[model samples]
Target: MTVPPPPWRRAPSPRKRAEKPLLSPELVVRTALDILAAEGIRAVSMRRVAQQLETGPASLYAYVSNKEELDELMLDAVLGEIPCPEPDPEHWDEQVKEQVRRQVRAMMTYPGIAKVAWNTPIPVTPNALRQGEAMLAFLRAGGLDRKQAAFAGDALSMYAKAFAYEASGWTFGEYDPAHMAERERRMADYVQSLPAGAFPNLARIGQFFNAGTSADRMEFALETFVAGLRAVVRA
Candidate 1:
């Protein structure tokens, strides 16, 4: 009876499922970030990540509660990559700006990671808390009270996240340069066509609309914010 049926006639030997690799928090986060890097944020999902890890979406819940939690984890992982410098009282303002610059640069590496940070308010993740602590130290070095430092740090974070999101859009080629150039040209033409008296301010500044590189703009923004911190502290 065991003389064997023909290979094709034999019922497929109950296909042996490949053993799934063990799941861990680090693995889950790394999988998600890999998906983000390869296919952008929109392609990353519990199902997608689980598929990449050779499991089901339900399996990811043991490691991450949900997509939002996954995003927080991803952002925290990115934050972990950035160095937190010691506070320098003599150059605290520059130090603060440098910290923000580092954050923006790191988030931009993964394109949409900054958006995740932007959506999360008061993230309690370890690296996020570390970043907050470092920023607070910088502000304290510059003479802000705890309340002022907290407020300033929050504002600076928002500004950096917003700028990172914007920079990512351009840096990652989300918008085609040729298309953007055409759109800008049409916009400039439309602005020029408007009556000068009806929209005097718009007409005056319209020429400078796309005048600066993103780095130039970021430099201006950071310098302005840091320079204004003392006034805010006094107020």
Candidate 2:
């Protein structure tokens, strides 16, 4: 009869197998955010993230339960980039506007995160909670009562998130000078072609419609909203 392999050579003991270092939730979240920033939100998946980490999907499960948890973690990670400001009653309006601008800028940096952010429930992450606390403090310093401060903060954040999400849908290539110029020309021509009496405002302001830069539009919108908030709070 042929000699059989020794039983001792059958397999290595579980204890002798190399132990994999525990994959931390923070590391997994950071990698997911990196993937999201490079490739849009749709590109982020547990398997894909695992591939990037050079591990099996099961390894990710040890940290993130599912894609939803990963997304929430990623959103929180991005929110952490915005720094909270010290509340100053003398400059509450300016501070609020600056903070909102920072939030929008952070969302824009990540491309698709803003769209996913608003859909996620008010995030429970410390960074997100800190942002809320800062906003509330600023509003209260502006003389708003507790309920008013809370509601105002929610409204302002919702507006900022909505605007950022809408803006993100427009790709960078679509904003090239030449492309925008052509777009403006087309838009103006279309508006001018409308019956004069039907769209007088649009026709008359056709040039003005394309006059300002994107930065100008953003500033104008922020100013108008802040002005309205001041009126409402003072009233």
Candidate 3:
């Protein structure tokens, strides 16, 4: 005899089955960023992201045209995290510096974004535009003409992004203490082993190759950049 209908079929149960979350642009970019944070940018493939979201890769194509689109979306999404402050005419330079710091801090949150920033043009997304505009406003408020402001803004932004990229060290896999020690050893050896006569300068300071803490270097860089930009302003 046929068994009574299974429970699920017997009464389409009062509770409806839980529906799976549908894929969206936000989810795809977010998932990709999470992967980029844990792994390198190369590790964030559509298939991999799809797997993370428990869906098929085809579903992501509807949101992102391809991996390039996905990368741009990821960049824009991260850029949105950087807070854009009001430009104070009285202390525009300081505000600009603060913006650079905020940018570097934000980029550092995602492990490999610094490298991505180098090749990818600045995204013209909503938040990214706001950030750029605020920076330009600061430069203009600090007595820079349109051209000077544009040039200085671009330079400051590039400097911040490049600094963050170098700091990340993800490209060289230096997160491990052992790897870093090996790198420092090789660097010191090569620098010290160089022919002293030909390379007097590097040889003399070779012992100080890995000298300062990262914070020290970053502070020096920020101060020097602002100083140089001020030179252009005064000139």
Q: Model 3 TM-score?
A: 0.83
Q: Give model 1's TM-score versus the native structure.
A: 0.83
Residue 64 CA error for candidate 3 (Å)?
0.7
Model 1, stretches more than 4 Å misplaced?
1-20, 171-179, 197-201, 204-212, 230-235
Whole-model alpha-carbon lDDT for candidate 3: 0.81
- Residues 1-235 of candidate 2: C-alpha lDDT, one tens digit per residue: 9987798786655677576555899889888888877877768899998988889999788788998888788888888999998999999989989998999999988877887788785788788899899999998888888988888888888977887886765644324667777988898888888876998766786544443465667788778877876887789
TM-score of each: 0.83, 0.79, 0.83
Model 3's C-alpha root-mean-square deviation from the true structure amounts to 4.3
Error of 2 at 58 (Å): 1.9
* Candidate 3: residue pairs that collide: none
Q: Using lDDT, give the best candidate's number.
A: 1
CA lDDT, every model vs. true structure: 0.88, 0.81, 0.81
Model 2 spans with C-alpha error above 4 angstroms: 1-22, 172-189, 204-212
